[model samples]
Structure formats: structure tokens, C-alpha cells
Target: MTPSTEMFDPATATIAIVTFNRSNLLSRLLESIERMDPKPGHIVVVDNASVDDTTEVVESFRERLAPSQLVYRRLETNTGGSGGFSEGMRVAYELGSTWIWLMDDDVEVIPDGLAKMGRWAPRFKSIQGRRYDYDGSEFYWQYRIAERMGIPIPFAPAGFDESGYKPMNSGCFEGMFIHRDVVREIGLPDPRFFIYWDDQLYGWLASRKTQSVIVDEFVLRRTREIKQWDMGIRHLNASSNAYRYYIMRNRAIIKRYYRALGVYNPVLFGLGTFMTFCKELIRLIFVERTIRGTSNLLRGIRDGRKIANDRSWQPMPPLATTSGSAPR
Candidate 1:
């Protein structure tokens, strides 16, 4: 039998993209969407108040992808990727989307990619699709959470069998397909995260409510190219200082979630955080080839300590119980 509660109309699925000043990349993504066999019914672009030709680029595609209702919600302030996805998902939900596809502006959906993803919607409430790097190599995304550290660790069994799908707990916003019911239960991605670890926690929370899985279906191609430190099994992309900062600082935020879930052990998590820090530090020196933002990393740990110390911290309330700007 089909999913008894949720509907699965490929046309009614909404693709929620979070974009910034990358208009060229945005245009390419929109063009890819325009080519879908049965195009998504809605396209919600949450602009993080980009001060560029982003508006012009989005407006240009508005008419060409007609009847699909391309919406451009430019935020008053730059809320970063975390806020952008949270806002984008909220908007799609209010637009009556049964399944919301989330992604950044740097990728293009491959031919029939959406169809491959849609094929399993009736059986799963949350799904993650595979992606390709700029060179067409499979981007290694298989991950399982390191619960003690509240971080993602690469999983074993790199390849799947004939089933073409495998169970997963890690979440990558680039190609996560989730149902409205999941949102109703967990609310939006915490905007306060503002950057890093947001998708990991969001996907983890979604997994707690449903059988989340990552399929072998090739869904999209990365358009932007960045130098990565080849690590044999996977590649580590060099990141900006901002990425370095938020990623380090977000550890405390993750701790808050695990604590709320009653699976926290201070000693274990504390040890895991240090190991995680050391690992990322190696990545920086090896990939970026500099000891930049070392202070920022240390500062993040200090601030995270404060957050963990706070006794009043609370998780996002369920959307079914409250109302905020679902889309603005």
C-alpha cells in the first residue's frame, strides 16, 4: 500500500534552495530545474540578502519556469545558510508541499534525478540523495553520527547491494528530501546554529522520527570547484575562516541537543570534542596549508563551554504547537 498519511505527487514536491551572492551558480541550478521531466510544483529561493545580481538572475528564471511558482524571499538580513534553509523549508511547508527538497545553490540536479528520488517517497519519510563532485567522481557522503561527540563520522560498507539504498542518520542539506510531517514533529532547523552542524542535527532529529536513508541514485552535480586534500577514501575541501569559526563554535550547540535527548555523558563528550578539534585542526593545516583561525577555534570551545553550562537552553518547539514567520 502507498503511504497512508502523506501524498506523493512528483509535481507537488517543492525544491527549497538557500542561496547567497552566487548568482552564476544560482542561474545554473535554476536552469537544471527548468529541465525536469515533471518539474517540481514549487521552487522557493531564500536569498540571504545578497548584494549582487542575484535578484536579477532569479527574476530572469521566474517566467521561464512558469506555473511552477518560483518564489524569491530575500531576507532583510543575512541569516547565513542555516537560517536560509530553515526559512526556505518553512515557506515550502506553508505552500502545501508534501515533500521538500533542500539544497545549496552550487549544484545542478542530474537528468531524471528528481524522478529517481521520488520513486521511494511513499516508503520513506526522510531521504538523502547522492551527489557528484565537479570532476564527476562520487562525493563521499556516507556518515554515521559519533553520538558522544555529537559529530558525524564516516560509515563502513562504502558500497550498497542491489537494493540501491542504505539506512542513514547523517543529514546533508544539499539533497535531503523530507516530508511535511517530519517538520511538524521537529520544527525547522535551529536558526541560531547560523552555520555549521545544523544539517547534521536536523537530519539526526528527522531520523529519530522516521526511517531516514541515503540512496545510491545520482541526483546532482557540483558546479563550483574548490581544492580538496585528497584523503584516499574522501576529499576534504578547504574552507574559509567563517566556516572554520562556526564549525568549531557549534559543538556546544550540539551538546545542548544531546543533553536534551538524555544521552549525554560530560566526560565522554568532552573527550570526543577535543579529538574532533584536533582532527579538524589537522585538516586545516594539511588542506588549507596554514594555521589561520587557530584563535577562533579555541574561542569557539570557550563559548561552547558557556552554552553547555547554561541551564535554561531549550530546543526548537514543534511547528504544530506554535507559529512564526513560516516564510519571510
Candidate 2:
């Protein structure tokens, strides 16, 4: 059936937010959500073991938003964004949501963002909304990548059409609205990723089976500064040791999955990897000027290579790693 012919209620969806040690931001996010014209049926907050007053903040919102409108799950340990999101999405799905909208605690939804997405939801299984910086400027997220190889094409932007829906190969978690059926098919985001590239992999999985697109609707305002240093050829963001490790280590996993699915390109992947290494090394040596940063990059690369080459590694099933509860 086509989306135009199907019936849907904006309130039937669940908005899942994964957060850690950011109560202030969470408060603002909840405030924004409270103002949504058609509020989501439920708001699932996956607290990644924050030692702060996150619980208290949630309780405060629960009082204002009503306990039934907000559900909180506090993890026993700190799972990075990947794990938090995995658990959050799982819980939201189990709560009988037809759609799950995933995001971090760092963004504020425009009052009508969900309303806008609701208008576009029926047409695509995976619908990604546009993002903007805190200054209200649109974020240029269209980086070019080898379509089949899944590697970035030099000096190119992903072909994005401003007029209509454009097919998406990958997307970020911020303002990403996905159907519950897609989760059942592809599984949850891998917690093993710990942080980087997990969303791209998840998006790729969705794109493989369903129509995924980046809609021109504005949904989120990123509160953080855009982070990127410079690749030898282009500027990218600098990162922490943990981010460096996962990014490098997880590339092999992404490559393996793409190849296993018959879309991997060795030449393109290899070239992308080489370029990434050079750019990161240069960032560490010149921009960052930290030996520790350099060490982390190299270590992450070494670990990533080992993971990529592992013969026994296999993808985990959806919900395989969830440490969260079903919605109430």
C-alpha cells in the first residue's frame, strides 16, 4: 500500500532520547517537546548511567508532562550513544509504537518538527529530517561517498535534491524517524560500536530494504559546535580517544557488513581508509599537537584492522544487546 493511502496518528509514535550526564540539556529538550502541537504518545529517555541529577530532572518533567507521557530507563552502566540508542529504540518498539523517532539529548525540536515529519512519514520507511546549527543555519551534511563502495568520493557532496525526496544511503541519529518494522528487519544499532559510524550502518541496513530519504523539513537544532579539524584535503572534526578508537575499529565492521551484503568495493574502501588515516595523523601532529591523541588514533586503527579481519565475527541480531525495559 502507498503511504498516501495508509492511516497514521502522530501521537502513536514514540520519541526516544538517549542521554548521559546532561540534565540541563535534557530539561530544555523536554521543554521543547512539551510544546509540540501534537505531542508524541510517549517519550522514552534512556539514561546511560549518569551520576548526575538526571533522575531528578526526569521526575520533574514527569510531574509536568504526566508519568504516562514520559518513561525513563536508567542503565546500570554507561553505554555509549550506540548502546543507549539501541536500548531506547528497543524499549520504544516493545511499547507498541508503530514508529520510533531517535535522537540524542543535545537537540531541541522545533515546536512543529514532529508535525512536519508526520506529514512525510507515510511515504518512507526511514525518514531523515534536516539539521541546523544552534545559530539557525542549515547544516551542510551532504558529503559525497562511493554509492556502492560506501566510501567518500573526493571533493563531492552526496547528491541531495532540494526540490523533492532524495534517496539516502546513510544518516545520523539526530532527527531520524524510523518505522518499527525496519527495526524488526535490521535489528537495533550495535552497542559494540560504542559510538561512531553505528548510525550510518543502521541507516544503510534500512536503505537496503526500504525507501529511505532525507526530507528538507527542519527538525533539529544542534546545540554543539560543528567538530572537525582538517583532512589533508578537507577539514573534519577532532575527537576524543574513545571516538578515535571506535571510528577506526568499527570501519572494518562496516566494510565487512557491506561486503557480505555484496556492495563492498575494495579499491574505494582502501582509498578512503588511507585518506582517513593520513588526515587524522596530521590533525594529531599539527592541529591537536598531542602525542596521546596520535597514539589513540594509531591504536584505534590497529584495533579496527584486527576487528575487520576477524573471521568469526558476525552481526548481532536486533535487540540482542538491549539492556533496557519495555515501555509502561
Candidate 3:
């Protein structure tokens, strides 16, 4: 199959950002984007109906991104990150964007980040860029998903510098650069997941049609400091209760996709889920110094099982040319 593809162009790449109530962070991100020497041809800001000054923040960038299309879409409700990205990507695609550069509002694009990522586009349909944490440390991002087990492959590369790119099946939306071809193949991201695990599955789907890799170029800077549990060898970010719930519940959503691919193993996936529970439990108890969110985590697993067992939950359909709506 001659892969359905498009020529890579930084100017025609649409920068898609999903922002909630974080107007402050969005402002900073917009400022960084404005500094890009070779700017994107379009920008799509998907606001999850934030009740803050997010609208104003987006408007402020209109003049800065002159002549370049700047679209600000405010959803009627807060659909979390998943729905936001889905809507944002659909809008970008409908606008005839060649490349959709997706990210959260919390990260600031480095001046040359888009350029560095653009270099890999002619060869790769899907690309991931390196990110620096708030503490200025390179984030651990390169890895592949164990589709059968529904987990990450253990002992993946921590970071890469010497190589131009490392083969990775997984993708981080915070700095994902993908051609519209992948979107045409895989469709917009699933929005059933209100938050967690959507990116991994979406990335996995993209890898099916094209070579997905993590480019060695630094592209983003995470602005907010997160609490980390130092394990002496490596540090792990602590999680919030909301994240814990979705992370636990979203396992079923992931399994749904795996099942479709004929790689889902009930026994192996059960073991993987067990391991995740144990790891998160330890993190909650020791790293967080509190088991307060234990109930939510357990509840999530229970809900996930129900979701998996339910017969009616369907996989996301391919995106329509003009509409981004799905059954609620």
C-alpha cells in the first residue's frame, strides 16, 4: 500500500492545544509559540468550556499569530483532555492542516521545537519529541505498548541523545507531531476516556500505519512542578485521585481496542492489571503518605471490569470530514 501521505511542512502544520482552566499556563505557551521563527500556519485552541479567562488568553494571541489561522473553539462543557484533543484534532483536519501538532496547555514550546520536529516529518508519519520537566530534567518518554498485556514494555530506553530518533510505538500528546495521513488512517482520538490512557492507544493505532518514533530533538518545557517520589535510582511523579480513578477505569477501554486487534489476552491482561494496582497502591501508600484515594482506585478497577463486560460499548468510528460529534 502506497501509504496515504502528505509532504511535511512546518508552515502548514496546525498547532492544536487543549486547555481547561489553566489560562496562566496557556498564556505562557502562546508566548512561546509566538516566538517560533518558522511559525505554524494554523493554531487550534480547544477550550473545555473553562469558566476562567481562557477566552481572553487565546484572543491575546490573535495579533501575535497574524495571517496564520488562529482558531479558538470553546466546547459547551468540560470534556477533559480526551474530548478536547478529539475536537481539536478534528477541527485541524477539517481545516486542511497538513500536520497536527498536539499538546497540553502546561508546556511551552522551545523556540526551535517545531523546526526540530519538522525535520523528521518527511520520513515519519508519526513523531514524538523530547520534553524537559519543570526541574529541567529530560522526561522518560520512549517506550512501546505491550498490546496483548495492555501495559508498557518493561525496561524501555530512559532517554536518547546520540541518535536522531529511536523507534517507539507509544506517543505522548504533549509533543506529538503527526501527519494528517495517520489521522486519516486511525481517526480522531477516542473521547470515551475522559482523560488517561487515550494517548497511548491513539499512538498505538498510528504506529500500525506508519513508523512511529521519538525524535531526539528537544521540543517542550513542562511549566508546573509536580511532586515526585525519588526511588534513589529514578523519580516517579505522584498522581492525583482523579488520575488514579481514570487510570484504573480506563484499562477496560484499552482492552476493548486490544480485543479488536486480536491481541487481548484475558489471563495476561489480568496479571498486568494486578501489577498496575500493586504499583499504584505502593505509590499511594508510601510516596503519597496516604491511602485516601484507595477507594477511588479500587472503584475504577471495578468500573473497568463492568465496561469490559458490557456488550454495547463501541469503538470510535472514523472521523467525518466536517463533524466531530459522537454519541454522549
TM-score top scorer: 1
> Between 1 and 2, whose TM-score is larger?
1
Q: Encode model 3's per-residue lDDT on 1-328: one tens digit a residue.
A: 1333445567678899999999999999999998986788889999999999999989988998866779999999999999999998988888787788999999999998888877777778788988898989887764687766777775676666686778787777888888776787788899889998899889988888788888778889999888888776567678988989998999999899888778788999888888888878988977799989988889999899899999987888765544422211
Among all candidates shown, the one with the greatest lDDT: 1
> What TM-score would you give candidate 3 relative to the actual structure?
0.93
Assess every candidate by TM-score. Answer: 0.94, 0.87, 0.93
Best-to-worst ranking by lDDT: 1, 3, 2
Minimum summed lDDT over a 10-residue window in model 1 is located at 319-328
Which lDDT tens digits does candidate 2 get at residues 66-164? 433799999999999999998998888878787789999989888888888888776777888887776677665643345654555456443456566
**Residue-level error in angstroms, candidate 2, position 52:** 0.9
- Candidate 2, residue 251: how far the Cα is off, in Å: 0.8
- 1-328: candidate 1 lDDT, tens digit per residue: 1232444678678999999999999999999998887788899999999999999999999899876899889999999899999999889988877789999999998868878888888788888988999998888785578767676676456788998888888798999998877888899999988998899999999888888888888899999999889888777777777776787788888888888889888888888778778877987899989988787788877777787788888988778734432322
Name the candidate, 1 or 2, with the larger lDDT value. Answer: 1
How many steric clashes between backbone atoms does each model show?
0, 8, 0
Candidate 3: global Cα-lDDT?
0.84
RMSD of 2: 3.7
Over 4 Å off in model 2, which ranges? 1-4, 152-162, 226-235, 282-292, 318-328
